[model samples]
Target: MALFHVRMDVHIPHDLDPEVRAQTVAREKAYSQELQRSGKWRELWRIVGQYSNISIFDVESADELHEILQGLPLFPYMDMQVMALTRHPSRID
Candidate 1:
């Protein structure tokens, strides 16, 4: 299967307090579970890049990936960029 690169442009709505950040952390984990139930969001690397978190998308195709993104709880609040990728020689190790 082909993979797509998903970079989320996040601007959190609430203040970045310890409590709120904690909630965000839990929500992020719950989001993974919600996505997992759909059988489309395969587990992949979530990178802590300087700007955004990058996740590799492994869905049917770009269109399907869009649908998957739309279904995500965080999608409504943030911007997204997705790029299709070929196999990389390195990474995922």
Candidate 2:
């Protein structure tokens, strides 16, 4: 499996309808949970004072990671960066 570091910043428009925002958040959370259960999403850390997050993912390939990310409910409103990871030569895993 390959490891990836993904950083995401949410950019939902301020004038968006409240009901739609609520539904979007709900779906996003549910989808995130689904990824967690599937073992593809490994860890998530919320950035303080911002609508952003840093996540670690374990997947087979970059294509699979892209597929999983595009499946997110908030993909349209998110600015994301994905970096492929490699084990450090000095580290044991």
Candidate 3:
């Protein structure tokens, strides 16, 4: 499996309908939790004072990661940065 670090910043429009925003956020939560339970999403940490979070994912390939990200309910309202991870030779478990 490949490992990745991802940071997501959300920016839902202020003018968006309240009901729609609530529904979308709810869906996002469910979807993210599902991924976490499945072990594809490894870790999640909130960035203090921001509507953003850093996450780790373990997946088969970059393409799979891309697909999982694009499937997020809040995909259209988020800015994301993704980095691939590799173990260092000098590191010991």
Candidate 2, residues 1-93, lDDT tens digits: the string is: 999999999999999999999999999999999999999999999999999999999999999999999999899999999999998999966
Give the alpha-carbon lDDT of every model.
Answer: 0.69, 0.96, 0.98
Provide C-alpha RMSD values for all models, in order: 4.9, 0.8, 0.5
TM-score ranking from best candidate downward = 3, 2, 1
Task: Estimate TM-scores for all models.
Answer: 0.60, 0.96, 0.98
The digit string of per-residue lDDT tens for model 1 on 11-52 reads 666655768666765876687677667665665455565446
Model 1 stretches astray by more than 4 angstroms: 15-28, 34-51, 88-93
Off by over 4 Å in 2: none
TM-score, candidate number 3:
0.98
Q: What is the lDDT of residue 86 in candidate 2?
A: 94
Cα lDDT of candidate 1 equals: 0.69
